[model samples]
Target: MLGATGLLGSKIYDRLHRNGHEVLPASRATGVDAYSGQGVAAALTGADVVVDALDMKTMSRRRATDFFTTCAKNITATAAEVGVGRLVCVSIYGADDPDAGRAYGYYAAKAAQERIYASAQVPATVVLSTQWFELIEDVVRRASLGPVTLLPAMRMAPLSADAAAAAVADVAMNPHSGPTVVVRGAEEADTLDLARVILQERGSIAGRRPRVLRQLPYLGRAIAGGALLPQEADTVVPGGIRDWVRAAH
Candidate 1:
């Protein structure tokens, strides 16, 4: 498991480790930096399947593209050299679809990342997942001004990190899924409403200075048009925002 210490990565690591799998959790903390290509091949020396839950904390087009593209090259080259069979990578829903809003900065970088991974030697099982309920807090923190919260007016079916991690870990261990797959939540919701549910549940908005929520077309029209939602055949993990907060908090 690469990037095995981050928000989603840690959940994947714990799930696999707790289930009696010999998961080689790799990250900067363990001296395995995928971005730098240091100690990456060594970690995959005897591994059969590699799960890439790597992430870059940037929304800039140039920086994100550079980071993901470099990481993909380094990871794929190393994995192919070490004879790793499959790479189970985490990705966002509609990353490969032009209509799903790749015009956005980060989404465009993700599409670039997907292109490199798709052309690599090792067969990759791209787990295209929807936004996670866990991301609500991060969005709120970044989009908030003094007393106003600016949100993207996107329609999403957000699942829990645990649910998405479970699916990723399953693919890593089983390696029986298709080249690409979709994972999502039980129902669709407006980003504004999702934020409200989380904020209210956490008591973040109750005692705060008078606050307001506003929606902006941060990702253009595709997001609000439901282009990023789950496909009809996709199997959604059960639970919604409230379910996640109750279980996690």
Candidate 2:
């Protein structure tokens, strides 16, 4: 697995490993940088398939675009050189829409990566997934200022890392007929509500629920509304929100 070390990537590696697949965890820490060709050739030399789960911190728009485009170029070139058969990439939901109002840079990078992989000689699958349940706590942890936690007013079907890994693994092991697939959680959730749950569970707030405020971009309400819950189809998973929170805990 190319990413093999991030929260999702680590889960993918563990799932694939438990399923008895010979796995390779490629990353800068492992001496294989996907952004550079340094050790990629050797890492991918005998691998049958590759899965990409690399991530950048915070999903900054400009940085994410550059990171993904560059990473895709590097991975594709090296995978081709090493004769890898298939590539599976984990992407964010709504990445294909040029106008999806996702504020994170990672979304644009994912879209660019999709285009690059689509044009590659090797077969590829891009599995676009909804938000991960872990993100609820993450956003709260990061966005919480004083006693309040600000959140984007958006819809999300937050999947577990394991479920997402299973989806990606299925794509990696199977034929790539659908170059793109959407994988969603079992239940839809509000970002603020999810944050509230986390905050309550973690004992971050007491008494009344901390204010649930909508976060707006300086651009305008259009960017905030459109970039965030742009409509999309449901990507089904078996477990529900409670299950995801339990697993995460």
Candidate 3:
């Protein structure tokens, strides 16, 4: 596990460990840096499976591209050197589609990472997942300006981080031979609706009325509509927006 302390990676680590699998959780805290190639080889030694759940905080195109490409190159090369057979990568849905999310630097970098995996010496499986329920807070924060919030008129299907982590663990342990697989939530929703739900939940938490004008605007340069929705054939995880909101309360 490359990012064992992350939001999704920690859950993956716990699930894999609970299943009686010996997992070496690697992260910055564990002194493993994929960019500098520090402490990666020792972590890979005697390990058969390599799960790349690494994440970056920046959205800069050049920086993100460099970070992902360098990390992928270093990790894959080291894995191949140590005789690691299976490489599982966690990625976003629609990353393979060049037309989708072209305006976003993060998505573009993700696409580049997928290309690296496709051409890697060791066989790789990419687990494509939708947005997580935990992202609602960040979305609300980014969309907010004073007492008003502008949401995108876009559709999204979001799953819990736990569900996504479970899927990753299953794929890593069972070893999916396919190049890519998708996992998503049980229901589809618009961005405005999600924002409303989150605001209402927060209001209830604080015991004060929520005051915010909600408006729908085009999300980004590229996200028009249905770009974030999962395919019909994609694996849908259990639970929906209402369930998640209720649980959050």
Candidate 4:
């Protein structure tokens, strides 16, 4: 299991371990750097399945593109050399769509990563998931200014991190040979509505209302209307934004 210390990766590692699977959790902290191929071979020795949950930190176009492309190249090469059976990658819901947030460096990099996996020698399964409920706070913070928050008027169906992890684990263990599989939350909502719920939750927590005006705009160049929304054929998880927020608060 690569990136075993991350939010979703940790859940996958725990689930695999609890199910009596012999899983090796590898990451930068464990001296397995996928970007440089350092310690990757030793980690993959005697391993049959590899779940790649690796994530990049940068959003710069050049840096983000290099980070994912390099990591994918190194990881796939090493996994193929080791004769790994299946390579499961966790990507975003709209990564395959050329018109979905293409201007965003992160989205473009993700699309490149998917392309890398699709052509890899080892059989690969790309599990695309929607935004996570855990990211609401960060999105709110980034969209906020002095006294106003400008959110994108885009539509999305977000799942909890746990739900995403569960879906990833199922794909990793089952070993499916397919083009791609998308997972999303049970309900669809606009970004503004989700932001409102987040603000309300925070206000209830602090016992005081936050004085902030909400507005909408086309945040990403390629995001408009329901462009980021998953298709009807995609798998829908059980929890929605409201259920996740209520349980969290």
> Which candidate achieves the best TM-score against the true structure?
1
lDDT of each: 0.82, 0.72, 0.80, 0.79
Per-residue C-alpha lDDT of model 3 across residues 1-249, encoded as one tens digit per residue: 898888999999999999999999987778889999999898887887999998887758799889999999999999999988799999988655555546567878988998899899998998899888887666666666665666556567888999999999988987655888789998887766776776566663122233664546453534546676666634798888778888866
Q: Which ranking of candidates, highest TM-score first? A: 1, 4, 3, 2
Please report the TM-score between candidate 4 and the true structure.
Answer: 0.92
Candidate 4, 64-86: lDDT as tens digits: 88988898999889989988888
- Per-residue error (Å), model 3, residue 153: 4.0
Q: Which stretches of candidate 3 lie over 4 Å from their true place?
A: 202-210, 213-222
> Of 1 and 3, which scores higher on TM-score?
1
Worst 10 residues of 3 by lDDT: 204-213
Give the alpha carbon lDDT tens digit for every residue of 1-249 in model 1.
Answer: 888888999999999998888988888878898889999989988888888888988878899888888988899999999999888888998765675436577877788888877888998888889998878777777778889888887888889888889888888887577787788898889888888887777778434432788788777788777877876535589878888887876
lDDT of 2 by residue, 77-188 (tens): 8888889888888888766656553444456677888899888777887888887876666665665666566665656667777788888877776774478877887676
Q: Looking at model 3, how many pairs of residues clash?
A: 0
Is 2 or 3 the stronger prediction by lDDT? 3
